[model samples]
Target chain A: MSTSTNVRLAGLHARYQFVETVRVPIAVIGTTLFPTLSLLFFIVPQSFAQDPAAATAATAQLAVFAVMSVSLFNYGVGVAEERALPWDGYTRTLPAGPSPRLVGRLLNGLAFVILGLVPLVLLAWLLTAATLPPSRLALTAAALLAAGFPLFAIGIGIGYSMSTKAALAVAQSLLLPLAFGGGLFLPPETFPGWLNSISMWLPTRAGRDLVVTATTGVDLPGPTVFVLGGWTLLAGSLAVWAYRRDEGRRFR
Target chain B: MEILARTVQATRCYGPVIALDGVSLDVPAGQLLGLLGPNGAGKTTLLQLLPGLRRPTSGTVELFGGYPRDAARRRRLGCTPQETGLPPTLRVHEVVEFVAGHFADPVPTPELLEQFGLTGLERRQSGGLSGGQKRRLTVAVAFVGRPDLVLLDEPTTGLDVEARHALWDAVRRYHQGGGTVVLTSHYLEEVEALAERVVVIDQGRVRADGTLADVRSLVPARRVRLRAPDLPELAGVERSNRDGDRHELWTADSDALVRQLVTMGIPFRDLEVATASLEEAFLALTAPGTQTVALIDGELAR
Candidate 1:
């Protein structure tokens, strides 16, 4: 097939997948609402809402949580559930190959991630002291996209390697710990010295720091980029390996 | 005849258990071939090989004169695995269209669904369809791309009588259009009704492969039922069962058995002689310890 035909087909597949996912309202509602609710109940009622710097940093941290939660559940639990379906196996046998489906799924997840950010952005702008210049706002958008890569990879890795039941448990269990340890739930400055040192290396911490610096004009530390890059490489490798293992286990 | 797919000495082993052992077969274009086998007789394994879903352990499988694993080569091939699921949330038409998008020239979505008896169900969610409807849809999806060859494994497994006939008509129409089909079924009547050629597989090997008549003749054991009391031993009778005063005898030579009964002055009435159905022929061919043989030119040989 020609390259253009392949691209068009991928676009079609992505649209259908997006429609299928959103038709189940709970999936969209849960992913988009949780982070926005956190910002409303916790950050909006606190003293941080009056401090421009603290409010912006807090919103960026919550944005990291929003992006990570959606990426984890959508790729991790979603993929594992699909692997058990007969339709998924049938599509693999088609001559068009796996690219269309993979690309479509990734694009669908991207749409939801963007949808999730909307409410949080609006709430922060209205009720809190979270303010960003046009340039800084653009930078934060780019930074959030960059941080999503490792989380997406980790979701895919867990999804392909585990059964549907196990993936649900793993994704759910991993979510809170990663969020808390990476200082997404509370400020990293409050951590004990050793905990503070350990939190900086977590992918969530790396993602949080990157987004916070982008939104608040803080200087990004030297290790932040390396930490996110390292996690991306490691998680990407795991995703690929898990996918291959799944294929071999089923079709071999 | 042009061969669309072929496997040469293809064998597949799942760990220590052998699912197929050194099986070789060729699929000719424009022919409807039926694979008949008991459960666990490797029928599914053989179909899986043709579609490149699984690789043979020690042999080669080819589709459209190329490696079966090549994605481009499968463009002309369509297959419905034994079990499949349709995305629950998508409408029936949407599911069909999504698959049709992958092909260079696909049959229109409306026409394909109508052919499969799913016309009015365009808006129905696949998950909400009845079992029979789901089965028909699965089979219909195979014809969407107008493939030259279609592989169906137990295509009518869960359909009611009416639904089965509908599917049969669809398959017949496809075959009449010069499409090649290779289907496996436990239903002897289904094979008899559809296949131009039959292959009986058992214990991971082919015990018979030929025209229906050729296979029936391989085990020419006719069933002879008669109401006879106190009948003497007959020379040509292979096996005999008695229920009250009725006796059912199976023999290769019913003519000789009847002559012996008459000549011995045995009083027999209500005699019934029935030819073997494909089910009996299938059972005789696949019976355990029966040496494997191929029928060539209406003659059986090892």
Candidate 2:
């Protein structure tokens, strides 16, 4: 196939995957609802809700958590469940190679992340003291998307390496701890000295810091960009390794 | 004749178990070949090798003059595994369209659905369809790409009698259009109905390969049924089963056995001589201690 056709096929795959996920909207609803509910119940009634800077930072953290949850459950558990089906096996045998399917899956994950952010962003804007200039809002959205790579890669790694049940358990076990340790639910300033130091190196914290910097123009104390870049590289490599291992074991 | 697929001394092992054991075979173009084997006989393994879904532990598998693993070569091939699960939420037509988009020249969705008797169910979700409908759709999807070679692994395994016949007609139409088909089934009658050439595999090895009649003759038995008064003890009868007043005798040569009865002036009524069915031939050929028997041109060559 020509390069253009390959791209078009990938687009078609993405469309089909999007439609398939939307047809059963429960999973999407749950993933989107959790973070929005957290913002409504936890952040909206607090004193932070009256301060623009504090509320913006908190909203940014929750936004990162939302994307992280979507990536972990959607890609990690979703891909594992797909692998258990015969349709996945049939699709793998097609001559289209893995690019189209992988790209399509990534697009699907991005869609869920965006869908998940809608309600949270609305709550932050209407009820809390969160504020962002339109340009910074766009930039923050872009930065959060970029920051999603490592989370997406981790999800893929877990998905390809484990069964659906195992992936779900592992993803859940990792998500909350990463969020808590990364100061997503609690501000890093209040964390114990050791946790505050350790959170700087965590991908979740790096992502939250990057989003906060983008949205509120905050200066991060740590090398946030470098930390995010390094985690992306590590998680990306792990994802590729897991995919190859799965292909070897199942297809060969 | 063009050779679409060939396996040369190919053996596939799943850890300690051998699924295909050094089996060499050829699938010529424009022929419908049936691969008959009992359960755990490696029929699925053999089909999987042809589509490059699984690689042989040793030797090679070639398709369309290239390696089966080649993507370009695979473009000309289509296959349905023993079990297929369609995307549950998508309508039947949508599934067909999605699969069709992958090929350069695909049959239109409406026409393909009609061919498989799925026209009325086009709007229905695949998950909501009956098992027989799902099976029909699965088989139909294989032909949507208009592939040069189609591999169907037990295509009508769970279909009712009428549905099985419908599928047979569709397969026949495809074959008549000069498409090459390699289908696997444990049903002896299915092979007998659809195949001009039969390859019988058992215990991960090809036990017999020949035309349908050639494989049937390998059994060395004929069924002779008759009703007679005061039947005599016959030396030529290998075994006899009595149902009602009729005696069914298994013999090497029914003609000779009948001649002996006539020469003895025995009065027999309602005499019938029937050749062994493919089921009997399959059993006799795949029986223990038979080893690998390859019949070339109606003669046992190996």
Candidate 3:
């Protein structure tokens, strides 16, 4: 008789197979097409640069794609689709332990961290003025991760909580505004007093400022880390809470 | 085959609609025990609980000797739920191999494909398979572990009679091999053919638990069929509208009834008797408004 084991080997097989299946779509939507779309964030922002300070605001606005990929599409849609597959029901029935099922699959969340950065890194390098010096590029990448934390946490969190349609709704509603508010497309400096104050702590704003500060050797350290760190922790905590509190039902 | 699959006061709720109430049952090894219940009668919930696909809201469920969720406990168990949703994109072999990898020693993909009558269809994607093929595939997966205990929900659901009977042969062989099976289905024929014992539930509670004979005994087993001289209406006899001058009556004492018919020499062309099968008893046990006990002890069933 064939024997049984509780190891989560099925989960690993599934993840690899999933990646292979989606590799083409991922290339088309995430790589080839995303760069072209990334260029479109600047369509309405040239005029914002009419004011000198708005240059910083415009940088923030342009960086929106990176954060969206990391936080929303990566965690949200990716996770929800996997959850929707009947294979998930298979996972539930398998002798595999939950820890094993959980570990190998969540790597896709980290993959989003990369998808989130591609455009912004591309955007930063395209503009010589915005490029981080080679000596500081590693730190900038680190800053991007820190900045993307809240968004990443929020992405996977909402992905777990909402159904496929609801996740799409949330991703659509939150994407542009998070970018707009964080100054990924526009300069936070040009915001009204209160709005600028709020932007100082927003994830997109913190990411843009940190990247910019790292590039130009600016003294924006103190508040930049705080804003990014705070959002990361808050979102992470919420995401974990949502995950733990889940009813464990395998449905929308 | 019987199994020792047991639950202790297990209860579950899907956001307030109670799925399983306080339920407890023990099925022995090497016998096929059927859970006969109508929809929403908590059969699925009970199966899900035993397989650890769900946690009991208020109590514990045990598979074999340990907690249901324990990996070791699950390793020896096989489960097939009613909704046999196979991955549409996976080729049949990929599905088997994937599940096989989780087991310490899984059935060979080729052997399984052959065993399930999918010999050359291993490359076929699950979505493209017919309904009967899908059920066969599900059966193969559940047996992947070569488990000692198998929980089958609606086992013969989509199979034709020939296919169902063939599957029954496999189940009987499994039992002969000293494995246990617990099944739940609406097809009483499947249950009668395979199950050595049947557990009937209604509205989240087990209404009856015993061998088919014990269940048949709950309601009389005898069904009187005889040729009467004329259409003499007898009390307790159900009218047969067929062109024959025969009548039928359901009862427990077939010999006594037959003797009475003969001793009286009642004007009848022919007379005979038979006991009720498990179906009538099951129907009576689960019928609405008749209070039946739950968590029965063996001695009490007699």
Sorting all predicted structures by DockQ, with the top scorer first, yields: 1, 2, 3
Q: What does DockQ give for each predicted structure?
A: 0.61, 0.57, 0.28
- Candidate numbers sorted by TM-score from highest down: 1, 2, 3
Writing each residue's lDDT as its tens digit, candidate 3 over B110-136 gives: 987777787898888777899988888
Global CA lDDT computed for model 2: 0.87
TM-score of 2: 0.93
lDDT, model 3: 0.68
Q: What would the TM-score be for candidate 3 when compared with the true structure?
A: 0.79
**Model 1 ranges off by over 4 Å:** B81-84, B227-247, B250-271, B294-299
Residue-level lDDT tens digits of model 2 in A1-252? 577777877887888888787888798787888899989888998987989999999999999999899889999999999898888878755657678888889888888888888889998999999998888977897889877889999999999999999999999999999999988888788898999889999999999988999999988656888999999999999999999999899878
Provide the lowest-lDDT 10-residue window in model 2 chain B. Answer: B76-85
TM-score of each model's chain B: 0.90, 0.88, 0.83
List candidate 2 segments past 4 Å from native: B81-84, B225-255, B259-273, B296-299
B1-302 in candidate 1: lDDT tens per residue?
A: 88999999999999999999999999999999999999999998999889888889989999999987777888888877333578889888888888787788999988898889899999998878888888888888888889999999899988889889889999999999999999998788888889988888888888888888887776556888999787787898777779988998888888888889889989999999887688987877777877756664366778
TM-score of each: 0.94, 0.93, 0.79
What are the runs in model 3 whose C-alpha is more than 4 Å off? A1-17, A20-32, A40-64, A78-90, A112-141, A185-196, A211-221, A248-252, B1-4, B13-19, B81-84, B225-248, B252-275, B294-302
The sequence of per-residue lDDT tens digits that candidate 2 reaches over residues B1-302 is 99999999999999999988999999999988999888888998898888787888998999999877666777878776334568888888888878787889999988998998888899898889988899988888899899999998888888999999999999999999999999988688888999999998988888888899888877656989899866788868877778767888888989899998899998888999988898987877777787756675467777
Candidate 3: interface RMSD equals 4.8
Preferred candidate (TM-score higher): 1 or 2: 1
Best by TM-score: 1
